[model samples]
Target: MLIPYTVKPRPDTGLINSKLGIWLFLASEVMLFGALFSSYILLRVNSVDWPVGSTILSVPIAAFNTVVLISSSITVIMAWASLKMGNLSKGRMYILITFLLGLTFMCVKAYEYNTKFHHGLFPSESTFMAIYFTLTGLHGLHVLGGMIVFAYFWGPGAKMWKTEPEHFTNRIEIVGLYWHFVDLVWIFLFPVLYLL
Candidate 1:
């Protein structure tokens, strides 16, 4: 005869609750980007040219992308909460939703970049284009990287999400923190690059 046993997590699993740890890491990331934006602001304020996007990018499109990124952040939270409640299936679906929104945001960003470059606003032409591309390009790569990570966890460990909820929630929490950081960076970038 054979019997099944329920395994308990090691006591040391509490070493650093993934949620809290990721939050701390994300906080540090926030400070890092804050410094970069402050530099961009100082550079912008001292420039002689006030007109940035004059005939280059579309304001409405950037605004739409902002809304999408913010909405994705909400979906990520919902996914984490769903996992917290032990609904692994719902959590997985929301994770996929968040991934889709992230992809959509990147697509929109690519389009905006294409439009700008097509109009002869190459980085070499001016410092504005240089800083603009540097900041936004780095931010876009982070978004794309997070999406890759999300896809990885979504496929492999999804089943563990149900039977081993602790680890599942931990993974989602880390990804959520990174996703939120990406969105937070954009929140500031949108104003600097598009609004003012």
Candidate 2:
């Protein structure tokens, strides 16, 4: 038997099962990050000397990563849109681009981490470094996770396009929501952890 409300919205909730599930997941994610952000603020406010973000972090690198993430957000949307428009090949191209952009962002983050480690800076070095690493590291992990999901849809999961087009599109839409949330978090983090 087939599941109800997988593609169509449930009358009471106005969202499909996958969309509702993603929003609930994102809500919990928001709470987790909010608590961490509040802790960062409390730590900074109570500290005697919080290192200036620009002096400690590479602003240029972080800014570039920001662009990369924003680009991925656009590409993921395009991928979903392409699928909705009944263009499987185009959708595949957009998803591939999104994955590559995510990979690029990760590489840049790795480089930034390597530079800091080479300079003998670590999360344990100071309160400022600790908060910085904690926030950005968590965000990076989210990016990695999104990439893996997109990669799956791009590869083996693409078969769903022929077998269950609406379900496949819904999957992409759900993943796109998660990807946009990840990108949005980085948008907030870039300034808080790198520019400020």
Candidate 3:
């Protein structure tokens, strides 16, 4: 059986099925991250001797990651815009750049993690380290998931643009929304975990 409203908006909700689904998912995500942020605040506030973030983390590396994520976010938007303007080749190029930027961010993060491990800075080393690892690790997982989806769309999924152009463009836009969220989370994290 064919599902209704996969691409077109529903009369009552004015949202296609996938668009509505992503928004609902993002709402739940907000709550989940909100709780984690609240916990971080409480933990930091109650600690008797909280180590400064700059002292424990490499600010320069994180700043570089911040730039990477920000650049990826820009590319994602450009990819969607190119698709909307009926430029499939341009869209693909922008998305490839976005994917490469995401890969760069993950590589830098892995290097940072390796450095921390070599220095005996495991999560169990301190309260700040535990929260830091938990928050950044979870965020990294989101980035990985986004990249997988982007990769699929960039490769085999490109076939959809030939058959169902509108749906394919919508899919790219929806993924862009998700990519923006991931970038925003990293923007918040870079400062909170690296600067102060």
Candidate 4:
């Protein structure tokens, strides 16, 4: 059976089903990441020797990835706006741009990881390394997950736009919210893990 409130807002709650679902999902994600951040802070503060993040990591590369993610955030929002404006092709183009930007961020991260491995800086090398890998690796997986969703909407999922344009737009909006959160996490991570 077709789901009610997929596109329309519910009477009890002003959000459509997917919008409400994404917000709830994001709340849980906040807790998951919050626990990790809290643990990292406690560990670092307790340790006698914590390496300066900039000394151990490539700030320039991380900064570049930051720009890429921020750009993707903008593009994803633009994609939603384009769809809302009834421009399917334009929206799809923006979505493709966002996907590629995410890909770029992952590739840069892979390069950074390879460089670390080349220098023999494995997680076992130090506490800083361990947390660094854990945080970035987890964040990378989130980025990859968003890419998978974007890919679906850009490819086979585009078919929905033909018959159910409004529904398709709502789907894009929900995905955009998730994408923005991923970007925001990196914004926090960049300074915490790289600068500090």
Best-fitting candidate, measured by TM-score? Answer: 4
For residues 1-196, write the lDDT of model 4, one tens digit per residue: 8878987799899889999899999999999899999989999999999988999999999999999999999999999999999999999999999999999999999999999999999999999999999999999999999999999999999999999999999999999999999999999999999999
lDDT of 3 by residue, 1-196 (tens): 8667878899999998888888888888888777888999999999999888999899999998999999999999999999999999999999899999999989999999999999999999999999999999999999999999989989999899998888989999899988998898888888888887
Q: Per the 3 Å backbone cut-off, how many clashing residue pairs does candidate 3 have?
A: 0
Q: Report lDDT per candidate.
A: 0.80, 0.93, 0.91, 0.96
Task: For candidate 2, list the clashing residue pairs, or say none.
Answer: none
lDDT over C-alpha atoms for residue 157 of model 1: 65
On lDDT, the stronger of 1 and 2 is: 2
- Per-residue error for 188 in candidate 3, Å, reads 1.2
User: What's the candidate order when arranged by decreasing TM-score?
Assistant: 4, 2, 3, 1
Estimate, for each residue in 60-112, the C-alpha lDDT of model 1 and write its tens digit.
99899999999999999999999888887888899999889989999998988
**Per-prediction count of colliding residue pairs?**
0, 0, 0, 0
Model 2 segments more than 4 A misplaced:
1-3
**Arranged by lDDT, best first:** 4, 2, 3, 1
